[model samples]
Target: MAEVEEVLSHPLNNTDEAIKGTVKLVATPVGTALAYGSLVFMALLPIFYGALRSVRCAKSKNSSDMPETITSRDAARFPLIASCTLFGLYLFFKIFSQEYINLLLSMYFFLLGILALSHTLSPAMNRFFPVNFPNKQYQLLFTQDTGETKEEIVNYEFDTKDMVCLAFSSVVGVWYLLKKHWIANNLFGLAFALNGVELLHLNNVSTGCILLGGLFIYDVFWVFGTNVMVTVAKSFEAPIKLVFPQDLLEHGLEANNFAMLGLGDIVIPGIFIALLLRFDISLKKNTHTYFYTSFFAYIFGLALTIFVMHTFKHAQPALLYLVPACIGFPLLIALVKGEIAEMFRYEESPKEVSGDSNQEKKESEKKEN
Candidate 1:
């Protein structure tokens, strides 16, 4: 037995092959049945819903009243449906394959499964807590349906329903993270959630630091890049209204400045927000809830990026970097006012004058009596 063990551990040509065989044998039965089963389900369920919704849309042709809930535009559906369907089929093949089952199949399916599961729950999370809610003090900055005045969107009200949904999603992610014995996906999920919370808490942050640098990447590449592409491709494929000089692309400092090349994308928007609130008191418009949610999300992600960079000595003190964020917070708030009101349906807030109407009705009833 000792001789055989020594032979196996030797640095012979066949030793590498022997070790690989051993590793595979050890890994085969390690994966739990439940993990594979969930992967199969997640992959299939989205495809099913997407297909069914598409069919329903087809059957109800030209019926604007029965619009698709999953997506407003028809072009958006194909990619989403196709991706989920393909992912599901991939998992199924992995689960059933005899030779490839436990090797490449097991590892790849697990990763795909987490991505699908996250997508399945993200929309409901955005809706309930609504990362953005218009505050009364700043309501005048933009006109909500109620015509209230506010400086920035206030999130004083907490939705228990949303809290419950978030809690459930957290629990699900945590459970999967632990059961799957994976660190990367777990960390990514946690980071995503933290970004959501940071978005909710942003106010009066500045710009022009590593954090801002981080935010540019987070927004332009991670968040805005995908969203802009999808928006243009699907919903707003309309022709660009040509306006020269106003929208001209120049070269040099004329073409690119501190605002254009670096933090300007975020800073410029922030400045516009500040100007809108300062100059255009009559600018009464709102954006979608997603606009605000994602707005702060990018801001917070920038903060995190700065903090992490500082930790590695790639940047200066965290506070110094945050000056830009501190300054930009108000600007972002102003920029998002119109969108926020439309999103929360500020037009739907219960009327305060109704109590006076009720009192008048009571007096009329007394006279009748």
Candidate 2:
């Protein structure tokens, strides 16, 4: 899921607003199609790759690899938090100079984006490390003692390959900071989206529904009901959204006509799709029916968002289209297959598992007695 501090960007009009107060570049029909096509492709890559990685992370014995599961409470409160932050930024932009606000935001995201990119690239970078390389392990530990009780504050483990990934990520981060290049921004945005999907787990289908449903209203209200979302999106200078130039054909690499999509749009729906993948794994079936169904539904939803935005020439809440397709498609399948009950019963949180284990142990003890 996206960080609560960042607002979701709408599909089409945010880009126009983003480049406002500057020279606006016009894009032809072919250029516009290409831009939209690239946006779709970019959005698909992270969700597919991240969903697979999330399954691996769930199965991994390493505690560090374990995903952070979202509960019903967290899902319910997400929209309220996001709306507060969105409006807060809108007010900040109104009170201060956009340049100064973005300067601070750019620096903050610079540090955050580097760490996210490094984490996202670590697995792939590890594969490329030469066999002869000395990949020494390192640990960073912090603890505090209170009346003979010690509490662990931070415990992190890494190796030389991880450092190498960080170094490479830092280079990209510097590039983004110095130039604010579209490609550099995209690099960080992709990293953020992939990591969010891989690390954030929805505990069950119901929680996923609550989250997407809440955000559906949030996105719609922000985009259609008021100008707060558009204002903040245009003013905020960060890699929280992925962007593609619409005039790449005419202007080549220097194209300024861009189209944007929020990482929230990708990451929020992405974690839900990932949860479906994990649910499929639990079924012990040879096929990934739910995963693929939700995946294609996401594609259709996003494509519909783009189509509607293009036809109407207006900004659209991506979640409005995405929520129904993502939730409905897999649900329809479950209903048809008579597995709706089983689908809702599946829970993967550590707390839930421990509770179940305790109950089973008590039941067994009573039987033995």
Candidate 3:
């Protein structure tokens, strides 16, 4: 396999320790399964959540807080482009970073993620923060194409609950900064995973497939054909990947050897699954055949990835198995039901997804009045 020339230098390129951690975990079947299960849960939970929220919003009067789906063919390319760029950037930084800037960058993201991921905790947190409390708004000025500039405001209110979450998460970052604890590493990892699933949107099945196909090849070449993926994965110390303690039950906490899964493996397949869920909601007939089928297929595919890695004692590209399973099962179901054409025709419109049809009409009436 071809290896990336280590063009830069970093202390985390401690290849000896990384190989030690990853190599022996294969022998522990229970640990391997446990780690894979935790990863799968984190990955799919947000997709399931967003999809459920999408269905609920479709039935409701307002969904302004819900995410809007993209409709333009050009717009759909953004996520794929962003993913590729980020992947390359991560590899570059991983091979360098003498000052450990990635952790600092991760700290900023973790702060934002704590707020975004804790929305479910908001209702209870509201007892402390309250809705009527003063809100803080930050503004950014953007220059438009027509020699005009517009200011956009983002509203956020920091309260007791937000403070506590932020303080505790900051403490975790500090711990990571000083000691490089797995606890802090995993916390940021989970938060980033949850944030991506919550915020990112894939426009449609066609867009999802395009992204997945490109990434599928990317993953295979890096993982199997080249040594770059494994080399970077071993060396990069950031939380771009999830790490779960494998020997917690047997060897206790001291056995810090972990089973790892990269975020790319999770997020790439997840967006496609979310698209399928929305497609099910759009059917408007209360059937979830495609959605549920794809969900379980994900479990099966992840299981196969782990099984093969353990059996062959090789680092496997998860998307090789995952893309086919996630995309294929749902397509097969649609084919069987003779809804393949309808499935292909399905698209998510922002107005429809956000339940904004009535809201737009109300705004128009105010203008006319």
Candidate 4:
């Protein structure tokens, strides 16, 4: 998730200008409520959609398509990596031309956004394909060695439906690249957030805690301790964050007054909530208590962030509000239910699960013999 920053004016066309001071937003109470409410609603959509998709992926037998899971160590190190990346971009803006940097970023995200959007649409697009459509299957394989020693480096399977999806996504990508429209930007942003939550797995509850906890500090420090995060956010023109026009009622579709929320705020806590959904599945209780609790907590936290930001007219670190709510709500539920130990012990590792299944099969065969 990138740092969430609200911008008052259109993105600067010239990068050579000095960093401007924050501009105040003046709007009616109803307009303010509507803008913030819409933001909260938009934020929830991706998290829920992504978490559900992640659960399906986790339960799927095929491991080829599953994204790499994040371990405790990776979670611990994420904040540091993010910090470096944030600070590095800040320095790059200082040393180099912002226009050139943003141009490169736009091109990079243009490609990435196309792929992500295509992937996000793949499942739905498959259903919509005409029955008579020539949906030929395709596989991409890259291997090394020979015969028994051959190692498969990459193996991806797709079909014509996927190609169609990619083509559609590319059109949207072009629109975003050329116009930088908020709706086009959001299409890419939502796809990115959905993919992030769906693919990035936390091994267990503890790892999720480590990640959310670390990011909480990272978001707070970068946002408040220094102006690095805000500076990069203002200069960086990419579809990395979701923006809502605050003055939509007044300016309509051409509105430039925008309120932005970083993808990080959605994806980071989202993975944890998804993990709880998985944990609920593992219990085989047909209940989604933990998942729902955390999901609602995320909404509450984000709403709180907006309220406080509105009241103080300052850029507030969303994670400061989100992290505690997401973690605490579920944890409190677990504690009250006397499932704290069980919650901590629950973990999901594909390799280990497969190995154990294989071992059990072998033992059963031996016993039968």
Q: How do the predictions measure up, each by TM-score? A: 0.21, 0.90, 0.74, 0.90
**Candidate 2 segments whose C-alpha is farther than 4 A from its true place:** 1-25, 146-148, 352-369
Error of 4 at 255 (Å): 1.3
Quote the RMSD, in angstroms, for model 4.
4.4
Per-residue lDDT of 84-154 in model 1, one digit per residue for the tens?
44344445544565444334533443444343334335444566554565422211132245523523233
Better model by TM-score: candidate 1 vs candidate 4: 4
lDDT of 2 by residue, 124-181 (tens): 8877878899999998888899743966577678888999999999999999999999
What is the C-alpha lDDT profile of model 4 across 58-173, one tens digit per residue?
76544455756889999999889888888888899999999899999999999999999999999988778778998899998999999759776887888899999999999999
lDDT agreement of model 4 with the native: 0.82
Which ten residues in a row are the worst by lDDT in model 2?
Answer: 4-13
RMSD of 3: 6.3
Give the residue spans of candidate 4 off by over 4 A. 1-23, 353-369
Model 1: weakest 10-residue lDDT segment is: 1-10
Candidate 1 C-alpha error for residue 314, in Å:
4.3
Q: Which scores higher on TM-score, 2 or 3?
A: 2
Local distance difference test, candidate 3: 0.61
Clash count of each predicted structure: 28, 0, 0, 1
Candidate number that wins on TM-score, 3 or 4: 4
